[model samples]
Target: MIRRANPADEATIRDCAEQAYRRYVPIIGRKPAPMVVDFAAQIKAGHVHVAVDGDTFQGFIVFFPKGDHMLLENVAVLPSAAGRGIGRSLIGFCEEQARRGGFTAVRLYTNEKMVENLTLYPRLGYAEVARRTEHGFSRVYFEKIIGGPGA
Candidate 1:
């Protein structure tokens, strides 16, 4: 199941992100953005959700609606829980929520050093929109149009 994350889930959520993104720290030469995210602030804004199995938190996705699309800010899953479809489910949750909010698309950005995401996002139907160095990190941006043109 997936539901809005509350204050109680903050620790689990941060742990999950830390574990998931830890491998990339060496690759990126620093902790990735997700590692330093302020979950307390995110939760306070109601922009976080967690995927659960029974009583366990499997993963989380953070997002918010933008003018033309939902910005999928971050997504992380327990590496031990990989292949359980938690990541995709969280993304689907975000997309469905965006559709309900009348957004025509979803946008997301990731570090270019994360090769897995480059292939994964395209396989999931998100097309590359741009790539640039931002905040000293080489970032790749992607977007998926979920609604008709000119919505």
Candidate 2:
């Protein structure tokens, strides 16, 4: 089941974050730089959403409202659950909510080493608008116009 995450799912989200990003931390050369927000903080800030399969949390996506766009903070699916379209479904949900809320677009950033998402987002209609250095990693920024061409 995919739905808005409540504060009660903090622990599950934290575990998911740790397991998903542990390998990438070394590549990015930072302990906590790549992931500044932990599960507890994300829940408290009300930015975390999750995907559950029979009470087991399989994936999550976090985001925050910014100006006329929604900033996707992070999106992850467990290794065991990765090829099942969970990540794609999560992004679709985000886009639906963004458009429903009257947001013009949805934006997100990913590191260069995360090549899969670099390809995935673009293939899903997210256009790479810029790249920059942040917290010691090269970040690729992308945006997808939601309502239409002028959106």
Candidate 3:
């Protein structure tokens, strides 16, 4: 199940993000952007949602509205829970949110060094929209229109 994360889940959410993104540190020559987020603030602002399996935390997705689209800020699955579709489910949740909120699309960006996302986003229907250096991180931006034609 996926539910809005509260202050209490901040620690576990941070841990999951650390474990999921730590390997990318060396590839980027520094910590990924998600690593330094203030989870407590995000939760308090009602932006984080967690994926749970009964009593265990599996993953989490952070998203927010940006004009006509939903910005998918971050998503991470615990290393031990990889390949169980938790990450995908979390993303599905984000997409559902966009649909319900009357948003036209879902947008996200990942580090250029994160090759997995470079391929995965396209397979999931997102198209590359931009690329640039921001806050010292080279990012690849993608957007998936919520509905129309093949959508």
Winner by TM-score between candidate 2 and candidate 1: 1
Question: lDDT of each structure?
Answer: 0.93, 0.81, 0.93
Candidate 2 global TM-score: 0.89
Count of clashing residue pairs in every prediction: 0, 0, 0
Comparison by TM-score, 2 against 3, better one: 3
Residue 14, candidate 3: how far off, in angstroms? 0.6
Q: Write the per-residue lDDT of candidate 1 for residues 90-123, one digit (tens) a residue.
A: 9988888888888889999999999999999999
Residues 4-97, candidate 3: write the lDDT tens digits: 9988899999999999999998899999999999999999989999999898999999999988789999999999999999988999899988
Q: What are the candidates' C-alpha RMSDs?
A: 1.9, 2.4, 2.0
Model 2, 21-111: lDDT tens digits are 8888777676434256766776678777798898888999988789989888789888878889998888887887787778879999998
Clashing pairs in 1: none
Compute the lDDT of residue 49 as modeled in candidate 1: 96
